[model samples]
Target: MKNTIILSILLLIFIFNTEAQKSAEVISIGEKVTFFSKTLNEERRIWIYVPDQTSFQKKIEKRYPVLYLLDGESQFYSTVGLVQQLSQANLNSILPEMIIVGIENTNRYRDLTPKVNSTPFITFLEKELFQYVDEKYRTAPYKLLVGHSLGGLLTIDILTNKPEMFNAYIAIDPSMWYADEQFLNQTISQLPKQKLTDRKLFVGIANSLPPNVTLKNVSKDKSSETRHIRSILKLGDFFSKQPNKGIQYKQNFYENENHNSAPLLTQYDGLRFVFDFYQSDLSEKDFQDSTSLIVTKLRNHYQKVSKGLGYSVAPEEEFINYIAYDALGKKHFSKAKSLFILNLENFPQSNKTHAAYADYLAATGDIANATEFYEKSLQIKDDKAVQQRLLTLTSKGMTLTESDLIQYVGQYVLDDYKITIVLELKDGKLISKVPGQADSEFVPVSKDVFTVKDKQGYNITFHKTNDTITGFTSVQPNGIFKATKKS
Candidate 1:
């Protein structure tokens, strides 16, 4: 009887544990959450996955980088699966663990593009939608933006107009010539002559169009059967000629893939490009034994690849330089400085290397050199966050009193839609808040001009009426609106 009772208890415990495990995995691979959006005039749905690390003890303290995916309904499962496999793969530690936030499209044309035309089914993605996601998620400052097809075009638009919106950008077969080539031409004209700082951009092109299709004939067939191969080629050439500096960029033409088939291969290649060094076979021993020898060998390898592809070296500094930064976080300043200089030598135009070196110098009390390099880094790109840091350091003795007029902000109501703005202070900095969240700090670019550090590519302008900060305007590529202080 005693043995039988013990066996029964064991069976019950096993059943209970099995049920618990099944319950934990019950959430669909791409579960959707409805978020209220004034920009879309309705509740917007987004797909999200918190990493499965919650089940592991070692991963309990880890916070992950966030990857905002475009076309969530279509690509979320594939990307989430890819991220999980690649990050955990020993052969390709090319990507870190990241929280995948798939932004579902209620209207792709409207939310992704900066401008809205008379297109029958289009939606716009203003600051309202972006703020909603950030407030609702535990996002890190490090972010990667991704898109494919029309989504790819949207990715380019976001990076070009608001480079600060994401730390890295990946676009797969982006429709470069869409909207009468509106975004393409705009990007070409506004392509900054200076280097981008601490930024990485990767674009891929594939045999997406059917044979012999041209952009000029796109209007002839409105059936979505037409492929604009010529236009994609033109875009490829344009991106190829774009100068490389603070931004490390590359373009790949997948001869074997079409527009629909391109995303899979392009995504793999793009992630490799973004995190090249993470997959390097180098070990600590290799660096310690012969640092110069390893760098030389790597340089040779880069040269061969660049020559074969008719392009320059892959921006090795962008990925390799992170090693030094990681070391510095542990207070190994000397090692960090050495790596920073090496990265600068490899990628002279990269503003990140310079900025990182400046930080190292500043930490060591070498103020003059630090200031010089910091200025040089700023000259590469008009990044608002970098500008603010430089301002505080340069004007060390200046006492600046900034107020959060963002709080007295009000709603911009458009018919059935409403946008809520809140202001507060955090970490000794003034921040703007949208509905459903608290305020975070804003980085000032110029006098009365400020932007978010994570980019999101928003500009907040305060309005003064009768000597009171009564209103403000938040501007993005989609549209502009004036919000008055709510009484």
Candidate 2:
């Protein structure tokens, strides 16, 4: 009777659910890369998130920094999510776009332990994994490694022995209590000898104390669970007094979180702590204060960042255009021009950049040069927005009126094809209506040329011979079609 009642309830719930019929789509997070280790004589599958460049033109020349993640199967998705969210153009923009390489573990015990003396993992990483990623993807010289728990224990090993493997290291809630805390001793002794240079480290210490025991009093209560936190605190103490100014090190203690829950916040703080110079948040007053100096400040900022990253880092094109568009909106023509030109100099081949510069030129009363840029932009890539802008400038003094929209309001039929196109004038706009299709509004860019709004067909160019409108060419995605007015 209970099973029958439960089944009946489930059936009723399913019947009421509108979304029950929908099938879940499979999401491919990243591609799998197999790294064959010559030293260890083993094969390992690695998960890598390379930037999607199939739609981007000339992507072969682009390169990005790499963020190597340990314990990949457990943390790859979370790290990838953070990378996408923070590196977006309009969002946080705290970090540069990086290729996230997550190393999936086949066996955790042999590879990640310091006591087993499995120094072969270092050979696998420096030789096999690093080379595999660099050769397969467009990667920069700078690299960052993030690890947690057992992974963090391994991270400390590489930071001590193979310090040149990565530019920055993040270790979260490591099992420093392993084998009588020998790894803690290694960190203490090795850090003093290592020349830190530009290397950075961010340590995340989680609160795994017993209930009712505060951090201040946890040291006195020697329990088996508290041993891990105690070892991490000892390492933190050594990091605090490490007299190397060249090495950048910071420790964040999360009193609310435990060992497993600390990684989410740890990875976030670690990235921000390492790449503090990547964010370029400028207030309105910064641009308004001195129109001429804004662009200069931006250039100097990126220049300093490039020196630190050991590569020539250019400011993102979207960020520069964001500032430039803001300047243009505020009527600061000089600042707008300077910022836009600087972007064009940095990213001359970008279609959107060219279109932005063209808009600036047209606004500043430079029609001749604006046309030149619009043509250049169209040459690189033809966009309906750019095409409409170009036609607007070229078709000067020829404006479309409501009465003019009425002339094309009749049925159009193509002789070769059996398709019929109908245009109707509605509310001072010409809308196209076809059988089994949604209505699309035509926005007038010129007297006889129109671009349909809401991602419909392309430009509709009217054809006339001796001042008589005969037919129009409808630009479709497949190909162009001509239809003569029928009745």
Candidate 3:
């Protein structure tokens, strides 16, 4: 048993290495790196967070938006965690999965100041680092900039001067009072003049209150404690009134949060607000809805989503599968069939999809078609459970010609349940599709007593006369069941 287990582990490793598409394993957290910058002429350490990759069989290619967050060294972990959690399929789908580029600051004041040229740093980001990230990683054309305090002030500068640098901007308790509010004044002046189509801005204001002061009282106070809060509010008010130059915008005030603690809440709300349409909100009733209306709604929703993202987007595979199964469970066969067929067309290469389609077909009494797809699935990727399922009710071995399998192809009905099993010969292979079940391919273990393929020892003993087979017995785990040829 020990040797067998070890051998199985080795075999699995070999299979994984051979069959799985080659790519870097998904990093749940992120990797810290020291990257040399040509624009800044210095080596910088940054943290990078990439989303967990899609299943290899799901897509041939994919890309994601990049969110460049300021103050990497301090905020990388929490930011990455927020992205990972929110983007999970089972969780809220409001925020699309994105790559988080945590930019570590070597000189915060030098780069994030409105008083300085800071063009070199901007050039480093816009030209050097941005290009590097896009070239090296799978990133979409859209980029979002996120910052806090002084970093937020820099965010405003870029938004005002080079609006095209990023598609979206989030300023969390930004020091709008920087350089005596010079950058804030620039934002107020330039925001209305720019062609802001397809652009968005989110501002999060932290409550900067001295003891005994309130949100209402802070606006009235001329004291320094209220300066940061006052500036952010003024900017938010200004942004809200900007003409419809096609930009989407919103501002959130965290009354309980001060400058130091605002990023935590604002970051979460900012992401939720910015990419609100990214998630699907399929209710239980929607799942149980009949095929035509439900599919149309889903398709339309994703179409609008695709238009927004500047790329074609589809309903998540799992979400579709869930609806399909729910329809199937409710006996909505037409809806189930349509969804299964649609899913199969979208992801024909996926083993899971094939198995699902095959299941639907078999359950619907389309045994021959089910078996064909099941064989296709197994050929693409070996699945033992499927093999056992195919035999205990079903590959690698000596190949058999089409002529050799023709003898095994027939319809046989079981004695007790009177269940009819379909045997088929396709593309030089023999297949078994049991009643209301998936197809399993057969292996030629021997002449008359050939064992089912990939069954982990399950065999079918055939009763033959010369070259013609009369019947066969299923060697499954429950018990042996005999069947005679019906035609």
Each candidate: what lDDT? 0.64, 0.81, 0.77
**Candidate number with the higher TM-score (1 or 2):** 2
Higher-lDDT candidate among 1 and 3?
A: 3
Best by lDDT: 2
> All candidates' TM-scores?
0.49, 0.69, 0.69
Tens digit per residue, CA lDDT, model 2, 48-90 = 8865521132345668899999899889989988887787635
Residue clash pairs of candidate 3: 93-279, 390-394, 391-394
Taking the tens digit of each residue's C-alpha lDDT, what string does model 3 give over 1-487?
A: 9999999999999989877657546544677778899777789887887775322233335578899999878878888778777876456567787888999999888877765445677888888888889987889887999999998888888888888999889988899987788778888987788877888888888877788887766678888878888888889778777667888888888878878898988898888877877777667677756754677677777877787777777666766787788888788888888787767776777787787777777677554455556666777789987665454322333456887778788899998888888989877777888867778877664455555555443557788777678998766546788999986
Enumerate residue pairs that collide in model 2.
none
Roughly what TM-score does model 3 have, to 2 decimal places? 0.69
Better structure of 1 and 3 per TM-score: 3
List, residue by residue over 1-487, the lDDT tens digit for candidate 1: 9999999999999999999988885535445788676545678777887665322223343456678888988888888778878875453445655688888877677666556332221223436545655676555556788898788888877777677767788988888768777788777777675345767778877765555654445435544444355555566667678666567788787777777888877888888787664444567764554234555555665665444222354434545566666666666666666667778886677677778787777666654456557767876866776666656654451223544434443443322246666556555566566667655555554334454544343555666667666666656445576766666
Worst 10 residues of 3 by lDDT: 52-61
